[model samples]
Structure formats: structure tokens, C-alpha cells
Target: MNIQLRFFASVREKLGMSEQKAVLPPDIKTVGDVRLWLISRGDVWAEVLAPGRALRMACNQQMCEPDTLISEGAEIAFFPPVTGG
Candidate 1:
């Protein structure tokens, strides 16, 4: 499936892009799957998306969890968790 990915804050700086379109493999069905897939690319990918990272996700502009199922044209966002005082 083809999905749109948006990276924000530090994540965006690390990846060097704000957004991208990805054609995911059939085995990747959810946001978590996408994260793992990217990590598989090694180096920066593995570090940015490392296991247990406190990252936040959004699907189609709405906040979502990693288990959220994504479809063609769906927009997925990743960033560090936000905090408020």
C-alpha cells in the first residue's frame, strides 16, 4: 500500500525531510510495521526509530497508536512526544 509519511520536530531534522510518500511492502499493515520497516534500513533509521523510543504517531491528521491500520493515501505522522507545563 502507498501511504504518506510526515515527520515533525527533531524527527524531521534527523531524517532531513518533512514528508514523503512510501510504497510499503505487503507485510507492513500498520504504523508499527512501518516503523520497523524503516529501522530495517539500518543506521540513522534504526537510531531514530529504535525500540522503546517515546515517539508519537498520527493517522490521517488524528493522533493514533502504532497498531493503527493504514491504507493507501493515508497520512501518517511521527514525532517526539509533546509535553505541556
Candidate 2:
């Protein structure tokens, strides 16, 4: 399946990328699966998307849980948790 990926805040800086158009493998079915597949790329991807990371996710611009199902051409975003002073 094909999907668009967006990175924000520290996640973008850490990954040195802001956006991507990805063609994912069939095994990647949910948002969490996407994260795990990205982590498999190693390096910064693994560190930023690893389990236990304080990250937030969105699907098609709506905040969603990791298990959220994804479809072809969906947009997925990952970012650090927001905070205000």
C-alpha cells in the first residue's frame, strides 16, 4: 500500500526529514505496524519510533491510536507529545 508520512517537531529534526511518500509492505496494516516497519530501517528511525517513546500519532489529520487501521493513500503523522509552559 502507498501512504504519505509526515514528521513534526523534534521527530522531524531527529530524522532530518519532514515528509515522505512511502510504498509499504503488505504486512504493515495499522499505524503501529507502520512505526515498527520504520524502526526496522535502523539508525534515527529506530530511535525516534521505538517502543516507549513519548510520541503522538495522527491518521488522515485526526489524532489516533497506534492500532488505528490504515488504507491506501492515507496520511500518517508522527510527532512528539505537545506541551505548554
Candidate 3:
């Protein structure tokens, strides 16, 4: 499936990217799957999207979990957790 990916805040800075359009493999089905696939690229991808890291995700502009099924042409976003003083 083809999907649009967005990175925000610190995540964007770390990845040196703000947006990307990807044609994912068939085995990649959900948000988490996408992340893991990206991580397979190694280096920065693995570091930034590491499984133990604190990150936030969204699908089609709405906050979502890892298992959220992704559809063709869907938009997925990732960012560091937000906090306020």
C-alpha cells in the first residue's frame, strides 16, 4: 500500500525529515508494522522509532495505536510525546 508519512518536533529533527511518501510491502499492515519496517532500514530509523521509545502516533489525523490498520493512501504521523510544565 502507498501511504504518506509525517514526522513532528524532535522526531523530525532526529530523522532529518518532515514528510515522506512510501509504497509499503504487503507484510506491513498496521501502524506498528510500518514502524518496524522503517526500522529495518537501520541507523537513524532504528534509533528514532525504537520499540522502547516514547512516541506518539496518528492515522488520518486522529490519534491511534500501533494495531490501527492502515489503508492505501492513508496518512500516518509520528512524534515525541508532548508534555507541559
Candidate 4:
């Protein structure tokens, strides 16, 4: 499936890119799958999207869990957790 991936805040800085269009393998079906797929890309990707890492995710602008189902043209975003004091 084809989708748009977005990175924000420290995640963008760490990854060195903010967004990209991606064509996922048929085995990737959920947000968690995408995260795992990306983690396999290399060390940097693994560090940023690691399973135990603290991050926030969203699908089409609405916050979603790892199990969220994705679709063609869907937008998935990753970012660090935010805090305002």
C-alpha cells in the first residue's frame, strides 16, 4: 500500500527528513508494522522507531495506537511526546 510518512520535532531532526511518500510491502498492514518495517532499514531508523522507545503516533492527523489500520494514501506521523509547563 502507498502512504505518506511524516516525522516531527526531534524525530525529524534525528531522521534528517520530515516526510516522504512510501510504498509498503504487502505484509505491512498496521502502524506497528510500519514502525517495525522502518526499524529494519538501518541503525538510525531502529534507534528512532525502536519498540521500547517513547514516541507518539497519529493516523490522518488523529492520534492512533500501533494497531491502527492504515490504507492507501493514509498519512502516518511520528513524533516525540510533547509537554507544556
Candidate 5:
């Protein structure tokens, strides 16, 4: 499926892009799969998306879990967890 990807904060700086269009393989059926797939790209992707990293994700602008199913052209975002004082 084709999806829109958005990066935020440090992730954007590292990836050198705030947004892009991606075509995911059939094996990437959910948000988590996409994460792993991106990480497999190596280098910055591996570091920023490695397992155990404290990352946040959203689908179509609404926060979503890793298990969430993604649809064609859906917007998916990745960012560091938010904190407030």
C-alpha cells in the first residue's frame, strides 16, 4: 500500500525529511510492520526506529497503536514521546 509518512522533531532532522510518500510491501500490514521495515533501511532509520526506543505514532493525525491497520494513502507519523511539565 502507498502511505504518507511524516517525521517530527529530532526524527525529521535525522531523516532529513518531514514528509514523504512510501510504498509499503505486502508484508507490512500494520503500523508496527512499517516501523520495522523502515528500520531495516539501516543507518539513521535503524537508530531512530530501533526496538525499545521511546517513539510515538499517529495514523491520519490521530494517535494510533502499533497494531493499527494502515490503509492506502493513510498518513502515518513518527516522533519522540511528548512530555509536559
Candidate 6:
């Protein structure tokens, strides 16, 4: 499936790219699977998207959980939790 990936805040700074297009393998079915798939790329992908990290996700511009089902041409975004000082 073809999906769009977006990173924000420190996640973007850490990954060095704000957005990109991805072609996922058939095994990747959910937003969580997408994270694991990206981590498989190693290097920065692994660090920035490591398991156990506190991250927020969204699908198609709406906040979503990692278990959310994804589809072809979905837009997935990752970022830290919103905070205020």
C-alpha cells in the first residue's frame, strides 16, 4: 500500500525529514505496524521510531491510536504529545 508519512516537532528534527511517501509491504496493516516497518529501516528510523517511545499518531489528519486500521493512500503522522508551559 502507498502511504504518506509526516513527522512533527522534535520527531521531525530528529528524523531530518518532515514528510515522505512510503510503499508498505502486505504485512503492514495498522498504524503500529507502520511504525515497526519503519524501524526496520534501521539508523535514524529505528531511533526516532523505536518501540516504547512516547509518540502520538494520526490518520488522515485525525488523531488515532496505533491500532487504528490503515488503508491505501492513508496519511499517517507522528509527533510528541501536545504540551503547554
The candidate scoring highest on lDDT is 2
Instruction: Give lDDT tens digits, candidate 2, residues 2-85.
Output: 999999999999999999999999889999999999999999899999998999999999999999999999999999999999
Model 4 agreement with the true structure over 1-85: per-residue lDDT tens digits = 9999999999999999999999999999999999999999988999999999999999999999999999999999999999999
Summarize candidate 1's per-residue lDDT along 1-85 as a digit string, tens digits: 9899899999999999999989999999888899899889998889888978889989999998889998888998989998899
Q: Give the lDDT of residue 77 in candidate 3.
A: 98
Per-residue lDDT of candidate 6, residues 44-74 (tens digit): 9899899888999999999998899999999
Q: What lDDT does each candidate get?
A: 0.90, 0.97, 0.96, 0.96, 0.94, 0.95
Q: After superposition, how far is residue 76 of candidate 2 from its true place, in Å?
A: 0.3
Model 3: per-residue Cα lDDT at residue 80? 92
Of candidate 1, the 10-residue stretch with the lowest lDDT total is 44-53
Please provide, for model 5 over 1-85, each residue's C-alpha lDDT reduced to its tens digit, 9 standing for 90 to 100. 9999999999999899999899999888889998999999999999998989999999999999999999989999999998899
Q: When superposed on Cα atoms, how far off is each prediction in RMSD?
A: 1.0, 0.6, 0.6, 0.5, 0.8, 0.8
* Pairwise TM-score winner, candidates 4 and 6: 4
Per-residue CA lDDT of model 3 for 14-34, tens digit only, reads 999999999999999999999
Clash pairs, candidate 1, are: none
Candidate 1 Cα deviation (angstroms), residue 45: 1.0
Model 2: residues with Cα > 4 Å off, grouped in runs? none
The 10-residue segment of model 3 with minimum total lDDT is 32-41
The Cα error of candidate 5 at residue 47, in Å, is 0.2
User: For model 4, what is the C-alpha lDDT against the true structure?
Assistant: 0.96
TM-scores of the candidates in the order shown = 0.93, 0.97, 0.97, 0.97, 0.95, 0.95
How many clashing residue pairs appear in each of the predictions shown?
Answer: 0, 0, 0, 0, 0, 0
List where candidate 4 sits over 4 angstroms from the true fold.
Answer: none
